[model samples]
Target chain A: MSDTLRPTDSQSPQPVQPLLARIKRRSFFMYAGATAGATALALAGCSKDETTPSSAATNVSFGTGDASVLNYAYALEQLEAAFYAKVAALTTSPLLAAEVPYFAKLATHEAIHRDFLRTAINRDFGGTIIPDLTPKFDSIDFTKRVKAATDTKLGILDAAKAFEDLGVAAYNGAAKLFKGSVYLGIAGQIVSVEARHAAYVRDLITPGSFATNEGTDVLGFDRQLTPTAVFAIAQTFVEQKLDASTIGQ
Target chain B: MNFFNIIDLLAEADPDVLDRFSSRRAVFNSLGTVAQRAALATSPLFLGALFQKAYAGTASLPTDILNYALTLELLEADFYRQFLAAGQIPAGAAFDAITVIKTHEDAHVAYLHDAVIKAGGTPVTGSSTAGIRFNPSLLPATYADQLKYAQVLEDTGVRAYKGRAAELIGTDLLTPVLQIHSIEARHAAHIRTMRGQQPWVSIGDDLAADANYKAAYTSGVASSTRTTVALGGTTYGIPAFNPAQPSPQESNLQQGAAGTKLALLITTGIGSTTYLPDDAAAAFDEPLQAAEVLDSSRAGGLLA
Candidate 1:
């Protein structure tokens, strides 16, 4: 693209607002700047999420190459989808009535991620998507919103925080592994939403506690965990014996 | 290697080189005997990139990107600095949160300042630099008004990072850049929540709804084609705006590439009447072109 075509934002052509009041920094939709994209909303689109994940690959290995990086994401999204689906399903739970809708919204997002990755992997990589393993919820008490210090079972919020934080870190860490820019771009699309989710959950657990976690440091950098480290913690919630050692190699 | 001799050599080469190295504490050992430059000299994104730039006098994609990032960090750090000095922050969580966000912005400025130099480029300065300013005269006087700017800055920070992130793919720098990227998102979420909105960018979120703030959500580009970035002799392109999917507008619902966007509330529902345009819009944040970032009222536009 030539300089004539590019928006000369840095040139300061517009009138100055008091203290740059006109400057709007929100960048949620950076690529889709057209009404054409808006019109497509009415059209029926991508596949709905599979309600039941397959149990085919018990010892799943997200194989090498760019495919491995994607599979790693697929695994995490699957786990989150399952976790939130259960949270949303609670006929009775510890969550406040007002807070319930948030979890419901979360369920849909996770399911979308799960299905999107599943389809993309299957389409682009041709059957490279790993089988979705069953989640292990023995340690989580579905009835509780948060666990007390003495309690053994984890609360709903506890798991949500863990999953969202892990998801952000996993994406952040996994970006370098992608050889191609397209998948890396797609991963960037998803990870910010995960960070938003993580922030929201953190605030829920402790008000005003957003962005103050140990995963982030004084330098304001969030955590970036390699696949092996991510999988070690992720293993606790799933029954599958998955190996992520080769991911991003 | 003798530490003093190395420092002497470095100081001889450039008197301010030590100041440019931000991690002096980390560079030195308990005995202060280690060859400090050796640790950084081996890191390509650091000294190696700089050496090339110092001699070649040419900027790579990463250097340009870092300078772009540094410009904003300086702008943001200054915004909060003025806001905090004003002393109007509410006494509870708001105060704490703003303080933390300000700290992060400052850290970002410091971190990027050093990174830019280490990458073999001149670090962009705050206020005095072109396209970046912290105009105290322009700052909103009231806390409520300042929060609006804060929200805009934080969210813009997230988008700016995302827009340029693809260039860093496959580099060691992607991780740290991503680390910063997620924090920006976290800040955006918090600022939104503090503003009485959802943590995520919902369709027609108040900022987007406002005519003045609309650019915050849209790509500010007339075309759907994204600008590519040159990195390490490779150029990377973003998938074009799939008319089959959502556009860069915050309200666009369908998400994904040309043939594969999933229509959430429009086509499939999660059995909830509460399924909203907001959630669908919030699910996927777009990775816009650096040029698409608008001037005067949007992310990249915030400069100057």
Candidate 2:
């Protein structure tokens, strides 16, 4: 069965069987090969994606490892989902008719992202998942675009832009921390979409300002923020406190 | 077998393969004693696949990945150069904004080429490389068509970078590639907006007006026909042009191999009174494989 993994049966003679006979002469290659075999067997026996009930916690600690990464993403998604839900639900905001539908779409996307991460965490890590977060939006006006950068209250467009940009930077920085290729692929898929959202919102705020030097580096690389830095900014809008000190450690 | 045998096979297959490995050896060494042990513990099948995928075909080196990216960057940089050379784009802020994008593409081409050389791999600069040159004849003549084609190019570049990102895992190459990936996406949105299209890729964002080249949105490895170009007597086949997913069209709602669909509206309090399929589809963008990106590029006449 182990022979099936061989790159070319015709080229090299099988060395795995002989290595087992002389376990005391364990080399790095032998050790690696043995571990790889065991991990494959272990993974084959388990299904991490099976949906299971998980007890949620109050003060969300992203915990440790990749699960912590997913939970951190989940917490941010929850905040964005809530923010957009509020914006979409508003009946008296001074939004244009076309703008209302646009916000509605944004709300759906953020909700979908939140739910996807929640399901992923629940299925993969089970009880390590964070609880639903309550959002605080008193700093956002949701009525009008902020006239200046110093304004404490952000307009709907300003808030959306901030959230979308934050998400892009967060994902960009976090991709390197992922140990699994699967999670990295998923992050790659999602980060571009977030960038698309950021571009759209940035353009809506200021014409043709998408991908400007301010949002990206002088060489056009997008901004990347570490988890600690991201959560620091993100916590301001969330009613629930988030602890991501253990993430990706 | 022994680790030497596996590496020997890779080196024998491609002379530059060992150099690429050496460049990344430091990263693997720093994975720490425990992680190294875990790497050994992984199944031989898994490790075999990793090596094979990293070295398969003529395009399977870290240098190949960089060259592939350089090819796309060259194509984009040339496209903008032509757009500006034609004296067609209107002046003022829009022009300046486009100049920003154009300069970035130029910078990307330069940086990627330098990185390729620094990594001890030959950069594919469309010079002396057969069928790698930008075919301006394939581009649309009118300004509107120009912007639309630009949108297609930018979006295709976005997916192309994403499709091969996993291949670059555990190296310094990964972050830089992702940085460029997001930048390409930003360009896609900016071009889409300039074309009077939605910032997001909606259901009908297909580039080809003809049905034969319809796989624009959700393309993969087997989506288009493969064609080879000769450089210095060596034949290099452009990666698959069509996205290989079951449905390569942008209208696809299922994401990833698990086929997870976006159904946020089904959740309570989030349902829209008016059902809009495009909005749901547009809310999320799909990923393409390297072959799929090549296929889509050929369908658009960007690839030889």
Who wins the DockQ comparison?
Answer: 1
- Residue B167 accuracy (lDDT) in model 1: 65
lDDT of 1 at A221: 89
What TM-score against the true fold does each predicted structure earn?
Answer: 0.72, 0.73
- Summarize candidate 2's per-residue lDDT along A179-246 as a digit string, tens digits: 65556776787788889888988888888778877733658688888998998889779754566677
lDDT of 1 by residue, A81-170 (tens): 899999888888789987888788788877777776776677668757777678988889988889999989889999899999999989
Task: Please list the residue runs of candidate 2 whose C-alpha ends up more than 4 Å from where it truly belongs after superposition.
Answer: A1-58, B1-59, B127-131, B206-213, B218-248, B256-276, B296-300
- lDDT (10s digit) by residue, model 1, range B33-142: 44545655445465455434333412235767787677668778878877888898998899889899988988888888788778776666764433356666667789
Instruction: Compute the DockQ of candidate 1.
Output: 0.26
For each candidate, how many residue pairs have backbone atoms clashing (under 3 Å)? 13, 22
What is the lDDT of every predicted structure here?
0.70, 0.67
Worst 10 residues of 2 chain B by lDDT: B257-266
**lDDT of model 1 at residue A188?**
90
